[model samples]
Target: MTDSTAPRGGKRERLVTSAGERLHRKGVAATTLADIAQAADVPVGNVYYYFKTKDDLVRAVLEAQVDQVEAMLASFETLPQPVDRLKALVRRWDEMRDVIARYGCPFGTLASELDRRDDGLDLEAAGPIRRILEWAEIQIRQLGQPDARELAITLFAGVQGGALLAGALRDPNLMSGQVRHLERWIDTVAASSTQS
Candidate 1:
């Protein structure tokens, strides 16, 4: 007999997608396998068929988020100048403001949660967030800064802080300010690199 409870896209993919959405909305600690199962319209047994446990499901969600960032970086990678690539990245964020504003940045939330509770889940969640910072560093390095990595990390912190403030204030413009501040900071780095 066909497994009627099996998710349409297949168990693993559906579970990951559902888990990611729930994790984004309710956070990793707050999200339960049962919640994911309900979101995916599958049974708990089917969810278990894919993810052995909640941590396994969290890892899958983080992996998907990393894949998404990698896809985003692909387009930015080809830009001839690092500063131009940085600008393009900011522009892309402007386009994503609606979802980002509503969800409060999944990667940011994941990073915050990881800080609060360190575990295997932190390993999974922190990797993607680190990759984003690494990408920023790569762009910053193009400007020939002596401390590109440090600058990148600083910029990432600013963005995350801005996102938190925006979400707390419930103001989309506040969230966009984070992107704006980052862009301005990057421009200064680029200018200084050129003059030095």
Candidate 2:
């Protein structure tokens, strides 16, 4: 970027955004620079100008996802209670249930695929997931629970598992059910936390 205020609607950003779409739809190994270039409406040669290699594009997509997650979490902070913030997070995921049913959880799918490789990207792949779970832990702790970390894990694990099954079965309703159950369950946890 030329400056912090520069509009990110430029070719480079298009490439990264297009790459994220393709990667989420068609996994990393299957998406080519040409595919991203075509999707972004940039010439194949121009892709090399913005990204030296395919891995560079993948890393950029991961970084973009991290920024997205942070911005979203920051937005959730505006809610009054920790439980409300937590439900908002789940609601956010619920909003994407249809897409997740079609393409799986982008974060989970990409992270799992990258873990099979020896490249340093495996660590980068964990960045967004860690941030989400860590954010959840903070919220759970605010409920005055000593087992905040465990509860956070429980929350994330259940959601991720729901996403996986929703994708595998190509059923958005499955995710809807899961999220509804989760919201009710979070209420139960919150009620119990304050009591204990």
Candidate 3:
């Protein structure tokens, strides 16, 4: 589904896109408006027209990420089984293993940095993560797990922790190994539920 809130390739969109990438790589504090302008090929003066402050730009980025998370979870709903849908979650991270190894999770890194402050942006930054966790919980519930919340939390922790380790160590293998383990765990859960 198309998101009207999504940036649509104009100067503002370009600025938001650039900011998102830089925020993921260099972080919010380190990424200047000038840096985003240089990346988007827009003049620094023009960025202010779209976003008066860096926080505004970060909000736009978070909005886009929330939409993305929704889209991804919706896509997984097309799968034949809840177990396959759950496995698709880990597979997504596996597909982006190299990029994640370099910069950590896009939503995760931004949220981690923003969470250090008492600002409400902490909740905003975590929107995508919260969405994913909620989606996983539902999928686990579909699999008939009595403790779906706990299972989903374990899955979220494993994926995020794996991403953290991969990024910290600059090794994609950690993410790969983590996803493999998750695949097995999902199978076990699915099998146990069937036998129940």
Candidate 4:
């Protein structure tokens, strides 16, 4: 018998975690609400109780992903050195490999899926991602140029490209290479901005 409060603490978390994993592994198109319900060991109706629809579940999963990254970035921001923060970001990303391997990056996969559609669901799904990029822009600006926002967008694009390739090639190493390339570019840009 489950504890009465288990639904809010354990069961709800399990459903979201399972849904995120499924979304990462198979993407939005292939994953079904029933699949998440089964993976989470929650009844189908219970899953619906937590999430009104499949899209709602997906949005929540994406929001969770964004929140994790945002927390990492926030911690890095407190470190006092811009370059160190950048390096910390990379390290945090490296730590995400297992999650990436299991369910892909929710932001990358969901953004790709939503690109082709113009529905409210797609727009709603993109909110967290947009906020992330916005925050990243602020960080990038601190590192150098007035147009740091654009640089943040570029970095986000590169990461997504790397993730997409990782899924397609079935090799996380591809993501490593892409991130290395991004690091180099960031270093050069940051250095140049400091000199100017």
**Count of backbone clashes, every candidate in sequence:** 0, 0, 0, 1
Q: Can you give the lDDT of residue 124 in candidate 3?
A: 79
* Model 2 spans > 4 angstroms off: 4-9, 194-196
Lowest summed lDDT across 10 adjacent residues in model 2 is found at 1-10
In the predicted model 2, the residue pairs found to clash are: none
What TM-score would you give candidate 1 relative to the actual structure? Answer: 0.87
Sort the candidates on lDDT, descending order.
3, 2, 1, 4
Better of 1 and 3 by lDDT: 3
| Per-residue C-alpha lDDT of model 1 across residues 151-193, encoded as one tens digit per residue | 8888777767776776677777876877887788878889889
The prediction achieving the highest lDDT against the true structure is 3
C-alpha RMSD for every candidate: 3.7, 1.9, 2.4, 3.4
Residue 37, candidate 3: alpha-carbon lDDT:
94
Model 2, span 42-156: residue lDDT tens: 8999888777788988999999999999999999989989999999988877899999999988888888899888889888899999999999999998988889999999998
Candidate 4 residues 1-196, lDDT tens each? Answer: 7775345459778888998888877878898888998999988887777777887787778778777767866787787856566656655545565566545676767776866777676666676678768777776778777888888888877777777667666677777877788788878778878535
Instruction: After superposing candidate 3 on the true structure, give the runs of residues whose Cα lies further than 4 Å from its correct spot.
Output: 1-9, 194-196
Question: Residue 108 lDDT in model 2?
Answer: 86
The lDDT of each candidate is: 0.78, 0.90, 0.90, 0.73
Where does model 1 exceed 4 Å of error? 1-8
Tell me each candidate's TM-score: 0.87, 0.94, 0.94, 0.82
Q: Against the true structure, whose TM-score is highest?
A: 2
Q: Give lDDT for model 4.
A: 0.73
Question: Tens digits of per-residue lDDT for model 3 on 32-131?
Answer: 8899999999999978878878799999999989988999999988898999999999999999999999999998899999988777888777789999
Tell me the TM-score of model 2: 0.94
Alpha-carbon shift of residue 142 in model 3 (angstroms): 0.5
